[model samples]
Target: MTLYRATAPHGVRPSPNIWNHTSTYEIENRAVDPDGQLAAALREVASWRARTVLDLGCGSGYHLPWFAEEAAQVIGVEPHPPLVQLARRRTKRLPHVSVLPGTAQQIPLPDASVDVVHVRWAYFFGPGAEPGLAELDRVVRRGGTAMVIDNDGTRSTFGGWFRRGYPGVDPAAVERFWASHGWSRRSVDMGWRFTSRADLEAVVRIEFDHATAEAVLAEHWERHGEDSGGEGDSGLSVDYAVNLWWREY
Candidate 1:
């Protein structure tokens, strides 16, 4: 049974340039969740053993290996064909993992088939994700958990940049959307620390537009803590907060 089907919105998606440059996107992904706070947050809410895991928008499969380590079976679903191919390549050596070409509105999984559903940055934002939300309801069985790791761009130091980048995204409306749909949220701080300055610059480029990127770069150069892992010498990282929404149905 499928609760709701997913389809790409009429005109909103990451630019092809963004999708085409897969390596850059991966750098940004690595930088965003450097501390794995999202995973830890989900585990804190509920634990699993030999559970079935579904990673929506699994990208180039950067985190699949980690999930495969604990999950008895792991399935990664991504809409982009190239990314799906990349994800398949990433997991070729892991017998317990599989990658599929699909989207959130239409998760390529059976009804009530998964024990844990995990997504980061790639899923959830505001009203547009309602169908996808319903799909979650269908796939996550009773006692199962769905975790969405997205930035609470309303708070945190980088919040300003995020909010500015997407001015129309009302955080208030987003909170309402999730709450109305029977999901609960908890906020936690995570960090992203890159080992090299070049890696840091590459991440910034992927995250912001050219003008904003230039502005961010200049501002950072003027201020010394820019490359300091967003926390001075604390591994040169930034404190990122994510909203973990889950429901036991």
Candidate 2:
């Protein structure tokens, strides 16, 4: 969603990738986040006060400000220049926040410097994310925790859409990879709720195929604000969960 942060031939030129759909991705970001589930769940585990944090594949730097509010310093590494620029612009006033152009596979951070490493949908979950994992081991300090949040494509309300989007993505294998690495998990529920039906439909269109998008838009998940049966994903209805995995050295 941080298309503005993309640079060079990749950022300068448009990408067919969903992240390139900055507008829809932004809508999805707002729609998917109901009550700050990920943030709240992370807070439940531990506090980040005065800690040095790194956000891998940080998008628009939306979280950098929050990290700055509590941590002594927060650094965001993003490969996309537009997102890097946008993140930079977003956290320009926050001295503790810094956004850099980078990727998870080849992190630019020094060894054992980060107290906490947080990555969401940014980290690639296929069979080849090992380099990123090794880099995670390299940058995170001892006793520090790293949380990698990926979509639970195995089962959920919107699970089918995710499966269809990335047909070969194996959720089970990803869990196994993290677990074998000695990371523990904590599942947190989250959902998507859009104020406008149009916005909801817009987000769905970008998330799935036309048929799938229309089908999702037509279903009434739960009783929303004003209307009892509306054409939008309801926060209370969708079964959203985040797998918070961590480890300590």
**What are the models' TM-scores?**
0.86, 0.82
Candidate 2, residues 11-56, lDDT tens digits: the string is: 1223333455776776667666577887887877666789998998
lDDT of 1 by residue, 1-249 (tens): 011113443322454434657787777666666666766787887666688988887878887898888889999987766678899999999999999987788887889999888887763445678778888888988888887777688787566667766677788888888899888889878766666566766777777778876786566655655455443453346555667777776
Off by over 4 Å in 2: 1-18, 219-237
236: Cα error in model 1, Å: 3.7
Show model 1 residue runs off by greater than 4 Å.
Answer: 1-12, 15-18, 123-125, 225-235
Query: Which 10-residue window of candidate 1 scores lowest in summed lDDT?
Result: 1-10
For all candidates in order, the CA lDDT equals 0.74, 0.71
